[model samples]
Target: MTTYASGKIQTRWATLDDLPALKTLINRSIDALQVGFLSPEQIIASHAVMGLDTQLVEDGSYLVAEYDGVLAGCGGWSKRATLYGGDHSRDLRDPLLLDPERDPARIRAMYTDPDFTRKGIGRLLLQQCEQAAADNGFKTAELMATLSGEPLYIASGYHPLERVEAIGNGANVPLIRMQKILQP
Candidate 1:
């Protein structure tokens, strides 16, 4: 489903057809946006820690933001047990569904194209994900945020829940676990 169109930017559910572009956008975002916020080693580790969770696309929960038809950002909410990490992450994969009343919705794989930073793409994706989760009966949402992404999630009302690290290529990557109550 398509959501709010502000100027030339639009949001919609992502599909397998968009996978190639999404992968490119995600890699570019990780490469260009993680600088300063992450040590070079951490950035390398990030590649193993973050990426496209195709299940989100299959579940039809992932949303992509486009600026004049160019993919600018992507994110999604999930009912699955996994809290974060992409399909390729070395972490355990859990496809089990979560009960809306018992588990907070998982906000997975949020990324904004570096060229599109400060353009409201991330905010737009967050709004869409939160609203969709709420509509599906989830009362709260949680995400694993990179240092660079913490500011935006904080501004959007998510609070830190914990600090965790993902290890890859012998590099330690820090991540913040954050949550927010979804407004009814």
Candidate 2:
């Protein structure tokens, strides 16, 4: 766990118990934060592409950020083959474990509560995820960056490798594939 600035911020591994709150926060974040970055139709399609991946929680690899003891943000690194999207979004779920030496650890399901934006909650959760991945022997980390989240990923040392579209609900949402080498 980490604490910042007189205990205003804290971070810890997410548990199954956090699912309800996590779902609410994830939906809220997608609806509010994607406003300018996506067309109305694209935003609606985003719901089909982004959300909590229960596998992360089950793997004990997900982290949740808290501000004043309330959930502020969430994100986590994964050792599995899947790179992004909720379980409902994909039919061929790759549950295979990734080799840390070869596959980049996946940074999945990042979301910040709108009320907690600009409070470093995203940064806090991201830092934790990278560290956790490094500790597990991962040499690199990768994420599917939403149009609204690209800035943050770029600023955090991830470089864009490709721009792709997630197609669903008859709309296409743009996403950036980004990667970062973990500092030893």
lDDT of each: 0.91, 0.90
Question: Which stretches in model 2 have alpha-carbon errors above 4 Å?
Answer: 1-7
Q: Can you tell me which runs of candidate 1 are displaced by over 4 Å?
A: none
Per-prediction TM-score to the true structure, in the order listed: 0.97, 0.95
- Compared with the true structure, what per-residue lDDT tens digits does model 2 show for residues 1-184? 4444324888888899999999999999999999999998998999898888999999999998889899999999999999999978775258889999999999999999999999888987888889889999999999999988999999999999999988879899999999999976
Count of backbone collisions within predicted model 1: 0
Candidate 1: global Cα-lDDT? 0.91
lDDT (Cα, 0-100) at 125 in candidate 1? 89
For residue 161, model 2's alpha carbon misses the true position, in angstroms, by 0.4
lDDT of 1 by residue, 1-184 (tens): 6677877889989989999999999999999999999988889889888999999999999999999888999999999988888889746468999999979999999999998899988998899899999999999999999999999999999999999988878999999999999997
